[model samples]
Target: MSGGVDSAVAAARAVEAGHDVVGVHLALNRMPGTLRTGSRGCCTIEDSNDAWRACDRLGIPFYVWDFSERFKADVVDDFVAEYSAGRTPNPCMRCNERIKFAALLEKALALGFDAVCTGHYAKVLRAADGSPELHRAADWAKDQSYVLGVLTAEQLEHCLFPLADTPSKAEVRAEAEHRGLSVAKKPDSHDICFISDGDTRGWLAEQIEMEPGDIVDETGAKVGEHAGANAFTVGQRKGLRLGRPAPDGKPRFVLEIRPKDATVVVGPEKLLAVEWIRGIRLSWAGLPPAGAEAGEEFACEAQVRAHGDPVPARARVEPAGGDPASGGTAGGDPADGGPAEGEPADGVPGPVLHLTLDAPLRGVAPGQTVVLYQGTRVLGQATIDAATALDRVG
Candidate 1:
């Protein structure tokens, strides 16, 4: 339980259904100084207490598990590493893929538990073949399928989402209030939990040893001075503080962050729209998406960020490491104008995923997840390795 109204209500419903459920609250923080603090992050001691009270009311045992070390290694360290590598990553996705589902589920199974349940607003269904499939929750606004995109086929078997059928967050709160849970009125937490003050750039600055460098325009001309390239992400416009106005008298956005030489590339907003996204570490929730076979591409809706809107795109399975003869994709569109260019010369599928968007996508940074969905069914997921070839249109 997250010590939130949604989880509390979900727990109550699970217990009422005679599931013999035992609530498990994850204590993610290693060193929480006192009972309360100015840090209003979701994973607080107050939340643990609320979870405990709710479990007490449900007549179920509530146990707090200290997964702080695992969380720091998998989520926090991965977050810092991705930023340091000049890529934007979602820490919550990593947490779900690594800690909550993998580690916790493994432990739970060893303890004789059938499946682990959470308050995530997503649904799981069985196909005609009895294979498990993931779907969007009934509540679209509260749908969290994007973050949970990292779940794999094996993990889905041992996962349960009790609040998937809930109509809305407000109604969930109402249900919690009816159950007399105090967290029913608790304000929803915002921003990353580890980010104490909610300033990601500021927090990253302390963790990553950002080397001060120059902020340059597309022409390689210096436009401003920045403390570090790691602090900025692709598509960032504000906080640039360029030294001189653009020659065109328009705004400039971050086109790239090159940590190698500590240089940031800035250009017009139009330059942020990317034509194709090449991603690695592809994962399917259970089975490969329909028509995602070798040399056979299919269209689906793809979302880059957790809360970002999904856009139409074509997904295809590609070879993990392309043909050694195609030279290499050093972050540029292939000069070959043939269909085989996107499918690879050999037409063999690999561990990589190639998403050709119907329209150019803006602000698509490296290391973010690109979750593909056909209707409400989650097709698969991939970690964006690079986005190359800007649309270059005004």
Candidate 2:
């Protein structure tokens, strides 16, 4: 639990279901925040105390597990590195994959718990064949299944989401208030939980060594100066501080960040449109069905980032040969213009698949997840490796 109201209510619901629930709060980091006197992020000392208090009221046991080292290495470091490479990273997805589901789940199993439960606003269902499937929550506005598409089959097997079937967030809060839980009225934490001030650029600047660089227009003309290339992300429009005016007086957007050259590229809004995304690493909850062969292509809905609508696209399963797919139409055929080659002839699909969007998508960023879906069922997800405009290359 992240010591949030949702998880608190989830723990209570688990007890109401008559299961032997042991509340586990992961101490992922001890980073200081400006909230309470000694509080860090959501998992702060005060928040954990609130969790323990809820457990006490529910007559269940609670424990705090320290996984700070793993969290820093996996989630924090990865976030910094991804930004340094001129990509927008989603730390929450990384945390859920490496910490919550992998590390915490393993620990819970070692402790002999029947299954691990969380307050995520998504549901776990059984397919017609009784296979596990991840679905959007009843509360559509609060659905979080997109980031959770990274769960492996093993993780899904031993996981429980009590709030998935629960009512809306308001109703959950009402239930907590009815139970007199302390966190019932706690404000929902926004932004990255670890970055309390919501200044990721400031936090990143302090953590990594940076050099002043040029902010250039699409024509390579220097427009302004920035603290670092990693400070910006694709689609960023504000705070550019470009002193020049566009010929058309239209707004400008960040088209690209070239860390290698220490340059931030700005251009008209139209140039920001990207027609294709490539080199995605897909991870399914379970292996695909039998007879599904590597290099086999299928049509599915692909979501390039969280809170974005899923788009129709074709996914071609590729072998893990380290030669990532390159250049494809945003929503058209793969850049190779045919079946993906070099995939193993064996029926076993590799851990990665290459997806080509039918049309360019705006604000496609590297390091964000591109999750695939079959209707409401989550197929898998991959870290976005690259995005390109339809008319640029391929």
Candidate 3:
């Protein structure tokens, strides 16, 4: 629990369900004693104390578990590396995968707890065959199924989300207030808890080795210079130092970030329209049926980035082979072929799942997750390996 209102109420509900509950707050960072201060966000000494206080009021045992070293290596390091490589990374998904489910779940099992619970707004259901499946929460607006999609079946089996079947956020808060919990009116932690003031770029620059780079147009013409290539993300429009207006006086958008050459490629809006997306690092809560093989086209709504509306698409899953025929192209191959040997480039090594959109998408960025779904059920997800215009494909 992070000592937030949702978690505090979740603990209360668990105890009301007649289960012996013990609250465990994870210490995910180690700051100096002098620097310690109170905050509602996680990983802070203040948040830990709040969690302990809630547990104390409920008369349940509470303890802080130190997982700082593992969290840094898994979530923090991966966040910096993804930005440096010119792909946007979802650190929340990383935290859920590494910390919440993997690390915390393992510890809970070791401590003889039958199940590990969280305040996430998602639900788990048992199918007729007794297999577990994750579902959206009662409050559709607050559903966190996208981040929780990374959880495996084993993790789900041992996991309990008490707030999943609850009413709205308002209802949860009212219950806490009625029960007289100290954190009843505590505000939610909006940004990444560990990231203060929500300046991820600044935080990343401090940890990673970043060098200033040139901002260029599509034809490699230098338009401006940026502080660092790692600081910018695909589709970003602000903070760019493009001094002059375009021919049409419209703002330009980030089309690509060439990390190898340290260039941020900016172009007109039309140049950002991507009709094809190829992804790697595929993961699924449950694998699709055997018939859902690569080159076997299936129709579903694919979300290239979180919070964006899903788009109609035809997907052909390719499993670890360069089957050019199976993958659909918007057009033909680019004039310049594959990248030079020993250099990381688009279409490099990794698991590949090719998606052909029914319509073009704007601001499609590599390194974002593309979650595939059939209605509410998540089919699977893959990392945005490459985003290309229909004209670029052959």
Please provide, for model 3 over 1-394, each residue's C-alpha lDDT reduced to its tens digit, 9 standing for 90 to 100.
7777888888998999998899999888656131222342456766787788899988999988888899989988888778888888888888989998999999889978998888899888876778777777888777777788778778889878899977689988998899888888776765666674577778888887888889988878888888788888878888897975676889998989888888899989898888888767767666563455544668877876556677888886655544466332322224322111221244455445668888888888877888887777667777776777867763
Clashes found in each candidate (C-alpha, N, C closer than 3 A): 3, 12, 6
> Which residue runs of candidate 2 sit more than 4 Å off their true CA positions?
32-40, 289-293, 322-352
RMSD to the hidden true structure, all candidates: 3.8, 4.5, 3.6
Q: What are the per-residue Cα lDDT tens digits for candidate 2 across 241-345? A: 988888799989998888888999999998977665654456786656343344567887888766788888777665554334443222223345423333322
Worst 10 residues of 2 by lDDT: 338-347
lDDT of 1 by residue, 1-394 (tens): 8888878988998898889899999989876652433435767788889899999988999999999999999999989988998889888889899888988999999999999988899989998888888889999999998888888777888888988888899999988889888888887766788775678999998898989999989999999999989999999999999998898899999999888999999999888887777767778877886556453678888889777788898776654554343443322235421122343322334566767787778888887899999889888798887675534311
Q: Model 3 Cα displacement at 206 (Å)?
A: 1.6
List where candidate 3 sits over 4 angstroms from the true fold.
Answer: 32-41, 323-350
How far residue 162's Cα lies from its native spot in candidate 3, in Å, is 1.6
Q: How much is the lDDT of residue 193 in candidate 3?
A: 62
Using TM-score, give the best candidate's number. Answer: 1
Top lDDT prediction, candidate number: 1
Return the TM-score for candidate 2, rounded to 2 decimals.
0.89
Q: How much lDDT does each candidate structure score? A: 0.81, 0.77, 0.76
TM-score of each: 0.92, 0.89, 0.89
Query: Candidate 2 or 3, higher lDDT?
Result: 2
Q: TM-score of predicted model 1? A: 0.92
Instruction: Say which prediction, candidate 1 or candidate 2, comes out ahead on TM-score.
Output: 1
Clashing pairs in 3: 294-317, 331-393, 331-394, 332-393, 332-394, 333-394
